[model samples]
Target: MIPFSLLDYVALFWYITFWLCFSWVVDHSRLKHHNLSHLMNGHRLRWMRNMSTRDLRMVDTAIISGLQNGTAFFASTSLLAIGGGFAMLNSTERAIQLFSDLSIPVETTRALWEVKVLFLILIYVYAFFKFGWAYRLFNYSSILIGALPYAKTADEQELEIAIRQAAEFNSLAGKHFNLGLRSFFFSLALFGWFVHPGLLIVTTTFVGLVLIRRQYFSRSQTLSMHLLPEKE
Candidate 1:
């Protein structure tokens, strides 16, 4: 029989997983049936009929690339947090002590365990909100991409203006998604901090490495450049 303490950790782990999965479903559902022209330009097919094939293809690729890579990154981080939390639960008291020593109030010491639980709850909530918002912003970015004019347009001036608009809009949406992912690290660092300061630092470093690897080495992120330009 599993111990009740272990069960508690299991429950918390599942709770976090539930939210992450829920966000994934929501994200994928939004991505699956996208209407490129209407979404990008907020105009019907008639309005976008003037765009060149090359311009239309660029818009379609951007939407598909962003969703695929964003989903993979979200899944990876959620899994890491779940695994790390489980490991920390094995030494609950020590973890609590480490957290309390850092900055948590003494009056809350008796209720440290509860505080930790609350912190976990907050982390999950924050993560979901950020991820969900990013998904929406990416969707908006796709629409903006479609709104850009094709290179063959007679009006070179109009094409330049459209390109700038698309770039700015895509950049805005990309920032939100990237910032959302960074916010996850804040909670990750805190949870691990209470477990062991050294481990906390190590985990933090690993988190950075994982992000770098995903952005640079992961095939999914490589593909995402089709939607949002790769960062320097």
Candidate 2:
């Protein structure tokens, strides 16, 4: 395997590139509605033709949410893996201490380290599944948006149906991604704690700030209401 320093640089590079690409996809998707419409035919074309204003709003929110969750998962996991590797290298004594705390035998403790490696692998796997599912949900939302039934009467019933479907889809996608991001962040902190409690405290503080700012103060999210009106 590559050295921890090299791995950190690779992770940082991937995180930046993924963030930029996600942003571009969101912006392009919003601006290229006509192209998207043309690209999709038959059922998809008909659906878009029928979609209500509420459905459009929901679709927009879903796309933005998928991007947010996806970015968070990528960035957090990369940081965790790289940071964990460095921590293990610089703090072997501490790693042993942390891994051997259980009331298990010496043989068991050796096995436990192996298990910890597997645990970390599982965490990444879970994160990837969650992020992948979120992406699929957003894709489904886009398909639903395209398949909206545009009725001339524009009854309250139809609007309600569209809004509810869109809202639920977005919610499902958001929840999965949020869970994944949480897991990634917490696991990183756990690794840091083993390296040094002080480092764990710093990571925790930074993670908390990022979470708060993203939810309530980020430029895109904070002003989302004005940019894209709610369905209700």
* lDDT value, residue 38 of candidate 2: 17
lDDT of 2 at 105: 30
Residue-level lDDT tens digits of model 1 in 126-193: 66566666666666656765666666753878765665565555544544555566557545645553
After superposition, candidate 1 runs with Cα above 4 Å error: 1-59, 62-110, 197-232
TM-scores, each model vs. reference = 0.47, 0.48
**lDDT for each residue of candidate 2 in 1-232, tens digit (9 for 90 to 100):** 3223443344434433543443344224453222221122222323333446343456654655666566556746655765565554555456577656756432223333444455555666667677767667766666655555555556778755764575566556655666566557645644443333345455555665565455445664534434333222
Q: How accurate locally, in lDDT, is each candidate?
A: 0.51, 0.51
The global Cα lDDT (0 to 1) of model 1 is: 0.51
| Superposed model 2: Cα runs more than 4 Å off | 1-116, 151-155, 225-232
Output the TM-score of candidate 2: 0.48
